[model samples]
Target: MNQQLPLLFPNAISLTIKREDLIHPFVSGNKFRKLKYNLLQAETQQYKTLLTFGGAFSNHIAAVAYAGKEKGFKTIGIIRGDELGSKISENPTLSFAENCGMQLEFISREEYRLKSELSFIENLKAKFGDFYLIPEGGTNALAIKGCQEILTPEDAEFDYICCSIGTGGTISGIINSALPHQKVLGFPALKGDFLKEEIRSFVNKENWELLTDYHFGGYGKVNEVLIGFINSFYQKNKIPLDPIYTGKMVFGVIDLIQKNFFPAQSKILLIHTGGIQGIQGMNMKLRNKKLPIIEIND
Candidate 1:
Protein backbone atom coordinates (compact mmCIF):
# COMPACT_ATOMS: atom_id res chain seq x y z
CA MET A 1 0.00 0.00 0.00
CA ASN A 2 1.18 3.51 -0.75
CA GLN A 3 0.44 6.33 1.68
CA GLN A 4 1.24 9.98 1.12
CA LEU A 5 3.41 11.76 3.65
CA PRO A 6 1.63 14.61 5.43
CA LEU A 7 4.51 17.06 5.15
CA LEU A 8 4.24 20.18 3.00
CA PHE A 9 7.33 21.23 1.06
CA PRO A 10 8.24 24.60 -0.42
CA ASN A 11 8.54 23.18 -3.93
CA ALA A 12 5.15 21.48 -3.67
CA ILE A 13 7.01 18.19 -3.88
CA SER A 14 5.06 15.25 -2.47
CA LEU A 15 6.32 12.12 -0.71
CA THR A 16 4.55 8.79 -0.59
CA ILE A 17 5.76 5.58 0.99
CA LYS A 18 5.28 2.12 -0.41
CA ARG A 19 4.65 0.18 2.77
CA GLU A 20 6.27 -3.09 1.79
CA ASP A 21 7.01 -3.52 5.48
CA LEU A 22 3.35 -4.41 6.03
CA ILE A 23 3.68 -7.42 3.73
CA HIS A 24 4.61 -9.64 6.69
CA PRO A 25 5.34 -9.33 10.39
CA PHE A 26 8.64 -11.19 10.10
CA VAL A 27 9.57 -11.84 6.45
CA SER A 28 8.65 -8.37 5.25
CA GLY A 29 9.59 -6.01 2.40
CA ASN A 30 12.62 -6.76 0.23
CA LYS A 31 13.46 -9.84 2.23
CA PHE A 32 10.12 -11.29 1.22
CA ARG A 33 10.72 -10.26 -2.38
CA LYS A 34 14.28 -11.62 -2.46
CA LEU A 35 13.33 -14.92 -0.84
CA LYS A 36 10.08 -15.61 -2.72
CA TYR A 37 11.43 -17.27 -5.86
CA ASN A 38 14.53 -18.66 -4.16
CA LEU A 39 12.41 -20.62 -1.70
CA LEU A 40 10.27 -21.89 -4.58
CA GLN A 41 13.37 -23.02 -6.44
CA ALA A 42 14.66 -24.75 -3.32
CA GLU A 43 11.49 -26.79 -3.04
CA THR A 44 11.50 -27.51 -6.75
CA GLN A 45 14.93 -29.13 -6.26
CA GLN A 46 13.73 -30.92 -3.10
CA TYR A 47 16.13 -29.16 -0.77
CA LYS A 48 15.29 -29.71 2.87
CA THR A 49 17.60 -27.07 4.26
CA LEU A 50 18.43 -23.43 3.43
CA LEU A 51 21.69 -21.69 4.21
CA THR A 52 22.59 -17.98 4.23
CA PHE A 53 25.06 -15.46 5.67
CA GLY A 54 24.65 -12.31 7.77
CA GLY A 55 25.95 -10.25 10.67
CA ALA A 56 24.95 -10.31 14.35
CA PHE A 57 22.16 -7.76 13.95
CA SER A 58 21.33 -8.49 10.32
CA ASN A 59 17.71 -8.07 9.25
CA HIS A 60 18.38 -10.64 6.57
CA ILE A 61 19.32 -13.20 9.22
CA ALA A 62 16.17 -12.61 11.25
CA ALA A 63 13.89 -12.70 8.18
CA VAL A 64 15.44 -15.89 6.81
CA ALA A 65 15.05 -17.58 10.16
CA TYR A 66 11.33 -16.92 10.38
CA ALA A 67 10.77 -17.49 6.67
CA GLY A 68 12.53 -20.85 6.75
CA LYS A 69 10.52 -21.97 9.73
CA GLU A 70 7.27 -20.82 8.16
CA LYS A 71 8.10 -22.56 4.88
CA GLY A 72 9.19 -25.77 6.68
CA PHE A 73 12.80 -25.67 5.50
CA LYS A 74 15.58 -26.04 8.05
CA THR A 75 17.65 -22.85 8.15
CA ILE A 76 21.31 -22.18 8.86
CA GLY A 77 22.76 -18.71 9.31
CA ILE A 78 26.52 -18.27 8.95
CA ILE A 79 26.92 -15.04 10.87
CA ARG A 80 29.93 -12.71 10.87
CA GLY A 81 31.82 -11.83 14.09
CA ASP A 82 32.85 -14.97 15.95
CA GLU A 83 32.47 -13.15 19.27
CA LEU A 84 28.72 -12.92 18.70
CA GLY A 85 28.36 -16.65 19.31
CA SER A 86 28.76 -16.38 23.04
CA LYS A 87 26.55 -13.29 23.21
CA ILE A 88 23.58 -14.53 21.19
CA SER A 89 21.29 -14.47 24.18
CA GLU A 90 22.10 -10.80 24.75
CA ASN A 91 21.59 -9.75 21.13
CA PRO A 92 18.01 -9.21 19.96
CA THR A 93 18.48 -10.21 16.29
CA LEU A 94 20.58 -13.31 16.93
CA SER A 95 18.31 -14.44 19.73
CA PHE A 96 15.24 -14.06 17.49
CA ALA A 97 16.85 -16.14 14.77
CA GLU A 98 17.73 -18.82 17.31
CA ASN A 99 14.20 -18.89 18.69
CA CYS A 100 12.88 -19.23 15.14
CA GLY A 101 14.88 -22.48 14.72
CA MET A 102 17.79 -21.10 12.73
CA GLN A 103 21.09 -22.80 13.48
CA LEU A 104 23.69 -20.05 13.82
CA GLU A 105 27.36 -20.51 12.97
CA PHE A 106 29.48 -17.54 14.02
CA ILE A 107 32.67 -16.92 12.05
CA SER A 108 35.41 -14.34 11.91
CA ARG A 109 34.91 -11.32 9.62
CA GLU A 110 37.91 -12.44 7.56
CA GLU A 111 36.31 -15.81 6.82
CA TYR A 112 33.03 -14.10 6.09
CA ARG A 113 34.63 -12.33 3.13
CA LEU A 114 35.24 -15.73 1.51
CA LYS A 115 31.49 -16.35 1.32
CA SER A 116 31.33 -16.06 -2.49
CA GLU A 117 34.20 -18.47 -3.12
CA LEU A 118 33.60 -22.02 -4.36
CA SER A 119 36.09 -23.68 -1.98
CA PHE A 120 34.36 -22.23 1.08
CA ILE A 121 30.94 -23.38 -0.15
CA GLU A 122 32.30 -26.86 -0.87
CA ASN A 123 33.57 -27.04 2.70
CA LEU A 124 30.15 -25.94 3.95
CA LYS A 125 28.48 -28.63 1.81
CA ALA A 126 30.86 -31.23 3.31
CA LYS A 127 29.98 -30.13 6.84
CA PHE A 128 26.25 -29.39 6.57
CA GLY A 129 25.38 -31.87 3.87
CA ASP A 130 23.40 -30.50 0.90
CA PHE A 131 21.50 -27.19 1.21
CA TYR A 132 20.25 -24.38 -0.94
CA LEU A 133 22.69 -21.51 -0.57
CA ILE A 134 21.31 -17.99 -0.55
CA PRO A 135 24.08 -15.44 -0.86
CA GLU A 136 24.78 -12.83 1.75
CA GLY A 137 22.22 -10.00 1.51
CA GLY A 138 20.16 -12.36 -0.68
CA THR A 139 21.25 -10.63 -3.91
CA ASN A 140 21.44 -13.40 -6.47
CA ALA A 141 19.77 -13.45 -9.89
CA LEU A 142 16.58 -15.05 -8.58
CA ALA A 143 16.40 -12.48 -5.81
CA ILE A 144 16.67 -9.67 -8.31
CA LYS A 145 13.86 -11.28 -10.29
CA GLY A 146 11.68 -11.22 -7.20
CA CYS A 147 12.46 -7.56 -6.50
CA GLN A 148 11.28 -6.52 -9.95
CA GLU A 149 7.67 -7.00 -8.85
CA ILE A 150 7.89 -4.23 -6.26
CA LEU A 151 6.60 -1.65 -8.68
CA THR A 152 3.13 -1.91 -10.18
CA PRO A 153 1.10 -0.17 -12.88
CA GLU A 154 -0.11 2.46 -10.41
CA ASP A 155 3.47 3.52 -9.62
CA ALA A 156 4.01 5.09 -13.04
CA GLU A 157 2.67 8.41 -11.83
CA PHE A 158 5.60 8.98 -9.53
CA ASP A 159 8.53 10.97 -10.87
CA TYR A 160 11.04 9.41 -8.51
CA ILE A 161 11.12 6.04 -6.77
CA CYS A 162 13.60 5.83 -3.90
CA CYS A 163 14.86 2.97 -1.73
CA SER A 164 17.75 2.05 0.54
CA ILE A 165 20.54 0.01 -1.00
CA GLY A 166 22.26 -2.88 0.73
CA THR A 167 23.56 -5.48 -1.75
CA GLY A 168 22.11 -3.46 -4.69
CA GLY A 169 19.69 -6.24 -5.61
CA THR A 170 16.54 -4.30 -4.68
CA ILE A 171 17.46 -1.17 -6.59
CA SER A 172 18.54 -3.21 -9.58
CA GLY A 173 15.05 -4.59 -9.87
CA ILE A 174 13.51 -1.16 -9.45
CA ILE A 175 15.80 0.19 -12.12
CA ASN A 176 14.67 -2.55 -14.46
CA SER A 177 10.96 -1.95 -13.93
CA ALA A 178 10.77 1.83 -13.57
CA LEU A 179 9.37 3.81 -16.49
CA PRO A 180 11.81 5.78 -18.60
CA HIS A 181 10.43 9.06 -17.32
CA GLN A 182 10.91 7.98 -13.71
CA LYS A 183 14.25 8.02 -11.90
CA VAL A 184 15.01 5.54 -9.16
CA LEU A 185 17.22 6.82 -6.33
CA GLY A 186 19.07 4.48 -4.00
CA PHE A 187 20.56 5.51 -0.67
CA PRO A 188 23.26 2.97 0.12
CA ALA A 189 23.42 1.77 3.69
CA LEU A 190 27.16 1.23 3.42
CA LYS A 191 29.99 3.49 2.27
CA GLY A 192 31.14 2.44 -1.18
CA ASP A 193 30.94 3.17 -4.89
CA PHE A 194 31.39 -0.50 -5.88
CA LEU A 195 27.61 -0.85 -5.70
CA LYS A 196 27.45 0.68 -9.17
CA GLU A 197 29.07 -2.44 -10.58
CA GLU A 198 26.90 -4.72 -8.45
CA ILE A 199 23.73 -2.99 -9.63
CA ARG A 200 24.96 -2.76 -13.21
CA SER A 201 25.33 -6.54 -13.44
CA PHE A 202 21.60 -6.96 -12.77
CA VAL A 203 20.14 -3.96 -14.60
CA ASN A 204 20.65 -2.48 -18.08
CA LYS A 205 18.98 0.86 -17.40
CA GLU A 206 20.54 4.23 -16.59
CA ASN A 207 17.49 5.75 -14.85
CA TRP A 208 18.74 5.03 -11.34
CA GLU A 209 21.18 7.06 -9.24
CA LEU A 210 22.75 6.21 -5.87
CA LEU A 211 22.69 9.04 -3.33
CA THR A 212 25.50 8.22 -0.89
CA ASP A 213 25.29 11.13 1.49
CA TYR A 214 22.89 9.70 4.12
CA HIS A 215 24.63 6.53 5.34
CA PHE A 216 25.23 8.16 8.76
CA GLY A 217 28.60 6.33 8.99
CA GLY A 218 28.29 3.01 7.19
CA TYR A 219 26.28 -0.11 7.82
CA GLY A 220 24.86 -0.56 11.34
CA LYS A 221 26.39 2.74 12.45
CA VAL A 222 23.87 5.25 13.82
CA ASN A 223 24.00 8.50 15.79
CA GLU A 224 21.68 10.33 18.17
CA VAL A 225 20.55 12.66 15.41
CA LEU A 226 19.45 9.78 13.19
CA ILE A 227 17.74 8.11 16.11
CA GLY A 228 16.00 11.37 16.89
CA PHE A 229 14.87 11.76 13.27
CA ILE A 230 13.54 8.21 13.24
CA ASN A 231 11.69 8.75 16.48
CA SER A 232 10.07 11.95 15.29
CA PHE A 233 9.33 10.58 11.85
CA TYR A 234 7.51 7.71 13.48
CA GLN A 235 5.65 9.89 15.95
CA LYS A 236 4.24 12.00 13.16
CA ASN A 237 3.82 9.40 10.45
CA LYS A 238 2.98 6.33 12.55
CA ILE A 239 5.47 4.55 10.34
CA PRO A 240 8.28 2.50 11.87
CA LEU A 241 11.67 2.58 10.13
CA ASP A 242 14.70 0.51 10.96
CA PRO A 243 17.90 2.53 11.42
CA ILE A 244 20.01 0.68 8.90
CA TYR A 245 18.17 1.03 5.60
CA THR A 246 14.76 2.65 5.18
CA GLY A 247 15.43 5.36 7.72
CA LYS A 248 18.44 6.68 5.87
CA MET A 249 16.65 6.62 2.52
CA VAL A 250 13.70 8.55 3.91
CA PHE A 251 16.05 11.08 5.46
CA GLY A 252 17.85 11.61 2.18
CA VAL A 253 14.55 12.14 0.32
CA ILE A 254 13.38 14.74 2.79
CA ASP A 255 16.73 16.50 2.84
CA LEU A 256 16.74 16.68 -0.92
CA ILE A 257 13.23 18.05 -0.87
CA GLN A 258 14.32 20.81 1.55
CA LYS A 259 17.34 21.67 -0.56
CA ASN A 260 15.18 22.16 -3.66
CA PHE A 261 17.04 19.38 -5.44
CA PHE A 262 13.78 18.26 -7.04
CA PRO A 263 11.63 20.40 -9.30
CA ALA A 264 8.27 21.66 -8.10
CA GLN A 265 5.41 19.15 -7.91
CA SER A 266 7.56 16.07 -8.27
CA LYS A 267 5.87 12.98 -6.93
CA ILE A 268 8.28 10.67 -5.12
CA LEU A 269 7.62 7.18 -3.87
CA LEU A 270 9.82 5.88 -1.08
CA ILE A 271 10.06 2.11 -0.80
CA HIS A 272 9.95 1.03 2.84
CA THR A 273 11.90 -2.16 2.30
CA GLY A 274 11.33 -3.45 5.82
CA GLY A 275 14.09 -3.67 8.40
CA ILE A 276 11.87 -2.86 11.36
CA GLN A 277 12.98 -6.08 13.06
CA GLY A 278 16.42 -4.57 13.66
CA ILE A 279 15.10 -1.64 15.65
CA GLN A 280 15.29 -3.54 18.94
CA GLY A 281 18.90 -4.47 18.37
CA MET A 282 19.76 -0.88 17.42
CA ASN A 283 17.97 0.43 20.50
CA MET A 284 20.07 -1.84 22.69
CA LYS A 285 23.18 -0.19 21.28
CA LEU A 286 21.67 3.27 21.73
CA ARG A 287 21.00 2.57 25.37
CA ASN A 288 24.57 1.40 25.90
CA LYS A 289 25.87 4.71 24.59
CA LYS A 290 23.19 6.77 26.35
CA LEU A 291 22.11 8.16 22.99
CA PRO A 292 18.63 9.21 22.10
CA ILE A 293 16.65 6.16 21.10
CA ILE A 294 13.90 5.48 18.59
CA GLU A 295 10.38 5.64 19.97
CA ILE A 296 9.15 2.49 18.25
CA ASN A 297 11.25 -0.63 18.51
CA ASP A 298 8.36 -3.02 18.85
Candidate 2:
Protein backbone atom coordinates (compact mmCIF):
# COMPACT_ATOMS: atom_id res chain seq x y z
CA MET A 1 0.00 0.00 0.00
CA ASN A 2 3.05 2.26 0.07
CA GLN A 3 6.13 2.95 -2.06
CA GLN A 4 9.47 4.52 -1.17
CA LEU A 5 10.13 7.15 -3.80
CA PRO A 6 13.21 9.38 -3.43
CA LEU A 7 12.83 13.11 -3.59
CA LEU A 8 13.91 14.49 -6.94
CA PHE A 9 15.90 17.35 -5.37
CA PRO A 10 17.39 15.33 -2.52
CA ASN A 11 20.86 16.40 -1.59
CA ALA A 12 22.24 16.98 1.91
CA ILE A 13 18.64 17.50 2.99
CA SER A 14 16.55 14.37 3.44
CA LEU A 15 13.19 14.25 1.65
CA THR A 16 10.83 11.29 1.19
CA ILE A 17 7.37 10.60 -0.21
CA LYS A 18 4.75 8.24 1.19
CA ARG A 19 3.43 6.96 -2.11
CA GLU A 20 -0.11 6.16 -0.92
CA ASP A 21 -1.25 7.01 -4.44
CA LEU A 22 -0.06 3.58 -5.51
CA ILE A 23 -2.17 1.79 -2.89
CA HIS A 24 -4.94 0.22 -5.04
CA PRO A 25 -6.36 0.74 -8.52
CA PHE A 26 -9.90 1.58 -7.37
CA VAL A 27 -9.05 2.44 -3.76
CA SER A 28 -6.05 4.57 -4.73
CA GLY A 29 -4.14 7.15 -2.70
CA ASN A 30 -5.40 8.94 0.41
CA LYS A 31 -8.94 7.94 -0.45
CA PHE A 32 -7.98 4.33 0.29
CA ARG A 33 -6.58 5.27 3.69
CA LYS A 34 -9.65 7.31 4.47
CA LEU A 35 -12.13 4.67 3.33
CA LYS A 36 -10.53 1.52 4.75
CA TYR A 37 -12.13 1.68 8.16
CA ASN A 38 -15.49 2.85 6.83
CA LEU A 39 -15.65 -0.14 4.50
CA LEU A 40 -14.78 -2.45 7.34
CA GLN A 41 -17.44 -0.91 9.52
CA ALA A 42 -19.96 -1.34 6.74
CA GLU A 43 -19.11 -5.00 6.43
CA THR A 44 -19.31 -5.42 10.18
CA GLN A 45 -22.78 -3.87 10.18
CA GLN A 46 -23.83 -6.25 7.40
CA TYR A 47 -24.54 -3.43 5.00
CA LYS A 48 -25.40 -4.67 1.53
CA THR A 49 -25.02 -1.23 -0.05
CA LEU A 50 -23.10 2.05 0.37
CA LEU A 51 -24.33 5.56 -0.39
CA THR A 52 -22.31 8.80 -0.43
CA PHE A 53 -22.49 12.36 -1.70
CA GLY A 54 -20.08 14.54 -3.68
CA GLY A 55 -19.89 17.07 -6.49
CA ALA A 56 -19.42 16.47 -10.21
CA PHE A 57 -15.71 15.61 -10.20
CA SER A 58 -15.20 14.38 -6.66
CA ASN A 59 -12.32 11.96 -6.12
CA HIS A 60 -14.27 10.61 -3.15
CA ILE A 61 -17.20 9.62 -5.33
CA ALA A 62 -14.92 7.98 -7.92
CA ALA A 63 -13.00 6.04 -5.26
CA VAL A 64 -16.16 4.87 -3.49
CA ALA A 65 -17.78 3.79 -6.73
CA TYR A 66 -14.78 1.80 -7.88
CA ALA A 67 -14.19 0.29 -4.46
CA GLY A 68 -17.82 -0.77 -4.10
CA LYS A 69 -17.84 -2.35 -7.56
CA GLU A 70 -14.63 -4.28 -6.87
CA LYS A 71 -15.79 -5.39 -3.40
CA GLY A 72 -19.24 -6.52 -4.66
CA PHE A 73 -21.33 -3.99 -2.75
CA LYS A 74 -24.11 -1.98 -4.31
CA THR A 75 -23.07 1.72 -4.59
CA ILE A 76 -24.96 4.94 -5.11
CA GLY A 77 -23.44 8.35 -5.83
CA ILE A 78 -25.64 11.32 -4.89
CA ILE A 79 -24.07 13.83 -7.19
CA ARG A 80 -24.60 17.60 -6.98
CA GLY A 81 -25.76 18.97 -10.32
CA ASP A 82 -28.54 18.44 -12.81
CA GLU A 83 -28.38 15.30 -14.89
CA LEU A 84 -27.20 16.23 -18.38
CA GLY A 85 -29.38 13.38 -19.82
CA SER A 86 -27.67 11.56 -22.68
CA LYS A 87 -24.79 14.00 -22.30
CA ILE A 88 -22.75 11.73 -20.04
CA SER A 89 -19.56 12.47 -21.93
CA GLU A 90 -19.80 16.11 -20.87
CA ASN A 91 -18.38 15.21 -17.48
CA PRO A 92 -15.70 12.55 -17.30
CA THR A 93 -16.13 11.82 -13.59
CA LEU A 94 -19.81 11.03 -13.98
CA SER A 95 -19.01 8.92 -17.00
CA PHE A 96 -16.38 6.93 -15.14
CA ALA A 97 -18.60 6.35 -12.09
CA GLU A 98 -21.39 5.02 -14.29
CA ASN A 99 -18.95 2.76 -16.08
CA CYS A 100 -17.78 1.48 -12.69
CA GLY A 101 -21.37 0.38 -11.88
CA MET A 102 -22.36 3.18 -9.51
CA GLN A 103 -25.98 4.30 -9.53
CA LEU A 104 -25.93 8.06 -10.10
CA GLU A 105 -28.59 10.30 -8.55
CA PHE A 106 -28.34 13.94 -9.53
CA ILE A 107 -29.68 16.62 -7.24
CA SER A 108 -29.73 20.40 -7.27
CA ARG A 109 -27.32 22.40 -5.11
CA GLU A 110 -30.24 23.44 -2.91
CA GLU A 111 -31.03 19.79 -2.17
CA TYR A 112 -27.38 19.03 -1.46
CA ARG A 113 -27.34 21.73 1.22
CA LEU A 114 -29.76 19.67 3.30
CA LYS A 115 -27.50 16.62 3.22
CA SER A 116 -26.59 16.44 6.91
CA GLU A 117 -30.11 16.74 8.28
CA LEU A 118 -31.84 13.79 9.93
CA SER A 119 -34.89 14.35 7.79
CA PHE A 120 -32.83 13.84 4.69
CA ILE A 121 -31.30 10.64 6.05
CA GLU A 122 -34.72 9.34 7.06
CA ASN A 123 -36.12 10.08 3.64
CA LEU A 124 -33.20 8.37 1.96
CA LYS A 125 -33.49 5.40 4.28
CA ALA A 126 -37.19 5.08 3.62
CA LYS A 127 -36.40 4.82 -0.08
CA PHE A 128 -33.08 2.92 0.17
CA GLY A 129 -33.21 1.19 3.55
CA ASP A 130 -30.29 0.08 5.69
CA PHE A 131 -27.52 1.33 3.40
CA TYR A 132 -24.24 2.53 4.89
CA LEU A 133 -23.70 6.22 4.37
CA ILE A 134 -20.15 7.54 4.19
CA PRO A 135 -19.68 11.27 4.44
CA GLU A 136 -17.95 13.04 1.64
CA GLY A 137 -14.19 12.36 1.76
CA GLY A 138 -14.79 9.87 4.60
CA THR A 139 -13.87 12.36 7.32
CA ASN A 140 -15.16 10.40 10.27
CA ALA A 141 -13.22 9.11 13.28
CA LEU A 142 -12.97 5.64 11.78
CA ALA A 143 -11.50 6.98 8.55
CA ILE A 144 -8.92 8.93 10.52
CA LYS A 145 -7.88 5.68 12.18
CA GLY A 146 -7.00 4.23 8.80
CA CYS A 147 -5.07 7.36 7.76
CA GLN A 148 -3.15 7.29 11.07
CA GLU A 149 -1.61 3.98 10.01
CA ILE A 150 0.06 5.78 7.09
CA LEU A 151 2.62 7.56 9.27
CA THR A 152 3.31 4.80 11.79
CA PRO A 153 5.78 2.80 9.65
CA GLU A 154 8.20 5.60 8.79
CA ASP A 155 11.44 5.22 10.75
CA ALA A 156 12.95 8.56 9.76
CA GLU A 157 11.81 11.55 11.76
CA PHE A 158 10.76 14.54 9.67
CA ASP A 159 10.80 18.18 10.70
CA TYR A 160 7.74 18.82 8.57
CA ILE A 161 5.03 16.89 6.70
CA CYS A 162 2.98 18.32 3.83
CA CYS A 163 -0.21 17.17 2.09
CA SER A 164 -2.93 18.69 -0.06
CA ILE A 165 -6.16 19.62 1.72
CA GLY A 166 -9.55 18.60 0.39
CA THR A 167 -12.03 17.72 3.15
CA GLY A 168 -9.06 17.93 5.59
CA GLY A 169 -9.51 14.26 6.54
CA THR A 170 -6.02 13.24 5.47
CA ILE A 171 -4.39 16.33 6.98
CA SER A 172 -6.33 15.86 10.20
CA GLY A 173 -5.22 12.23 10.39
CA ILE A 174 -1.64 13.22 9.62
CA ILE A 175 -1.62 15.95 12.24
CA ASN A 176 -3.14 13.62 14.80
CA SER A 177 -0.51 10.95 14.05
CA ALA A 178 2.51 13.27 13.88
CA LEU A 179 4.87 13.47 16.83
CA PRO A 180 4.88 16.61 18.92
CA HIS A 181 8.20 17.54 17.30
CA GLN A 182 6.88 17.48 13.75
CA LYS A 183 4.96 20.24 11.98
CA VAL A 184 2.21 19.52 9.45
CA LEU A 185 1.60 21.91 6.58
CA GLY A 186 -1.65 21.71 4.62
CA PHE A 187 -1.81 23.21 1.14
CA PRO A 188 -5.52 23.54 0.53
CA ALA A 189 -7.10 22.77 -2.83
CA LEU A 190 -10.02 24.99 -1.83
CA LYS A 191 -9.68 28.72 -1.47
CA GLY A 192 -8.66 30.20 1.89
CA ASP A 193 -12.09 31.83 2.22
CA PHE A 194 -13.22 29.45 5.01
CA LEU A 195 -10.77 26.54 4.78
CA LYS A 196 -8.56 27.77 7.63
CA GLU A 197 -11.52 27.78 9.99
CA GLU A 198 -12.79 24.50 8.55
CA ILE A 199 -9.51 22.65 9.10
CA ARG A 200 -9.01 24.22 12.52
CA SER A 201 -12.47 23.04 13.47
CA PHE A 202 -11.58 19.50 12.38
CA VAL A 203 -8.16 19.10 14.04
CA ASN A 204 -7.19 21.67 16.61
CA LYS A 205 -3.46 20.96 16.60
CA GLU A 206 -0.86 23.55 17.56
CA ASN A 207 1.68 22.50 14.92
CA TRP A 208 -0.60 22.65 11.88
CA GLU A 209 -0.33 25.52 9.39
CA LEU A 210 -2.55 26.05 6.35
CA LEU A 211 -1.05 27.68 3.24
CA THR A 212 -3.87 29.24 1.23
CA ASP A 213 -2.01 30.61 -1.77
CA TYR A 214 -1.32 27.33 -3.57
CA HIS A 215 -4.88 26.64 -4.66
CA PHE A 216 -3.98 28.19 -8.08
CA GLY A 217 -7.56 29.11 -8.89
CA GLY A 218 -9.93 27.00 -6.79
CA TYR A 219 -11.09 23.47 -6.39
CA GLY A 220 -10.79 21.65 -9.75
CA LYS A 221 -9.44 24.79 -11.36
CA VAL A 222 -5.99 25.09 -13.01
CA ASN A 223 -3.98 27.63 -14.92
CA GLU A 224 -0.92 27.83 -17.19
CA VAL A 225 1.57 27.94 -14.30
CA LEU A 226 0.17 24.79 -12.67
CA ILE A 227 0.18 22.98 -16.00
CA GLY A 228 3.79 24.02 -16.54
CA PHE A 229 4.83 22.82 -13.11
CA ILE A 230 3.05 19.47 -13.61
CA ASN A 231 4.89 19.03 -16.90
CA SER A 232 8.30 19.92 -15.41
CA PHE A 233 7.74 17.59 -12.46
CA TYR A 234 7.04 14.55 -14.64
CA GLN A 235 10.04 15.40 -16.83
CA LYS A 236 12.34 15.48 -13.83
CA ASN A 237 11.00 12.59 -11.72
CA LYS A 238 8.93 10.54 -14.17
CA ILE A 239 6.12 10.45 -11.61
CA PRO A 240 2.63 11.21 -12.80
CA LEU A 241 0.89 13.91 -10.74
CA ASP A 242 -2.65 14.97 -11.41
CA PRO A 243 -3.06 18.77 -11.47
CA ILE A 244 -5.95 19.00 -8.96
CA TYR A 245 -4.35 17.61 -5.82
CA THR A 246 -0.76 16.37 -5.60
CA GLY A 247 0.56 18.64 -8.34
CA LYS A 248 -0.76 21.71 -6.51
CA MET A 249 0.68 20.50 -3.21
CA VAL A 250 4.06 19.78 -4.84
CA PHE A 251 3.99 23.21 -6.46
CA GLY A 252 3.35 24.76 -3.07
CA VAL A 253 6.15 22.72 -1.47
CA ILE A 254 8.67 23.81 -4.10
CA ASP A 255 7.68 27.43 -3.63
CA LEU A 256 8.11 27.09 0.12
CA ILE A 257 11.54 25.55 -0.41
CA GLN A 258 12.57 28.47 -2.66
CA LYS A 259 11.29 30.92 -0.06
CA ASN A 260 13.62 29.39 2.53
CA PHE A 261 10.70 28.54 4.80
CA PHE A 262 12.67 25.55 6.07
CA PRO A 263 16.39 25.25 6.62
CA ALA A 264 18.26 23.64 3.74
CA GLN A 265 18.91 20.54 5.84
CA SER A 266 15.30 20.05 6.86
CA LYS A 267 13.90 16.55 6.39
CA ILE A 268 10.41 16.58 4.89
CA LEU A 269 7.81 14.07 3.78
CA LEU A 270 5.03 14.85 1.31
CA ILE A 271 1.96 12.67 0.89
CA HIS A 272 0.89 12.01 -2.70
CA THR A 273 -2.95 11.99 -2.49
CA GLY A 274 -3.76 10.52 -5.87
CA GLY A 275 -6.46 11.80 -8.27
CA ILE A 276 -5.42 10.28 -11.60
CA GLN A 277 -9.00 10.33 -12.94
CA GLY A 278 -8.81 14.10 -12.52
CA ILE A 279 -6.08 14.13 -15.17
CA GLN A 280 -8.41 12.81 -17.86
CA GLY A 281 -10.72 15.82 -17.46
CA MET A 282 -7.86 18.27 -17.10
CA ASN A 283 -6.18 16.91 -20.21
CA MET A 284 -9.38 17.35 -22.17
CA LYS A 285 -9.60 20.98 -21.05
CA LEU A 286 -5.94 21.69 -21.79
CA ARG A 287 -5.82 19.84 -25.09
CA ASN A 288 -6.25 23.03 -27.08
CA LYS A 289 -3.61 25.03 -25.21
CA LYS A 290 -0.64 23.20 -26.77
CA LEU A 291 0.73 22.66 -23.26
CA PRO A 292 3.91 20.57 -23.32
CA ILE A 293 2.37 17.11 -23.52
CA ILE A 294 4.06 14.63 -21.21
CA GLU A 295 4.27 11.85 -23.78
CA ILE A 296 7.00 9.22 -23.80
CA ASN A 297 9.53 10.75 -26.17
CA ASP A 298 11.79 7.72 -26.48
- Per-residue lDDT tens digits of candidate 2, residues 1-298? 3343455443356556777777887678888998898999889999989999988778889999998987889998888876643556787888988898998888788988998899998998998777999997778888777877778655347888889988878888888888888999999888865766665766667888888899988988888788788887778767778788888998988887777788877888888888876777677667767654433222
Model 2: what TM-score? Answer: 0.90
Q: What is the lDDT of residue 267 in candidate 2?
A: 82
Clashing pairs counted in every model: 0, 0
Best by TM-score: 1
Clashing pairs in 2: none
Shift of residue 158 alpha carbon in model 2, Å: 1.5
Model 1 over residues 58-150: C-alpha lDDT tens digits?
889999999999999999999999998899989989999999999999999999999999999999999999999999899999999999999
User: Candidate 2 local accuracy as lDDT?
Assistant: 0.80
lDDT of 1 at 11: 75
C-alpha lDDT score of every prediction, in listed order: 0.93, 0.80
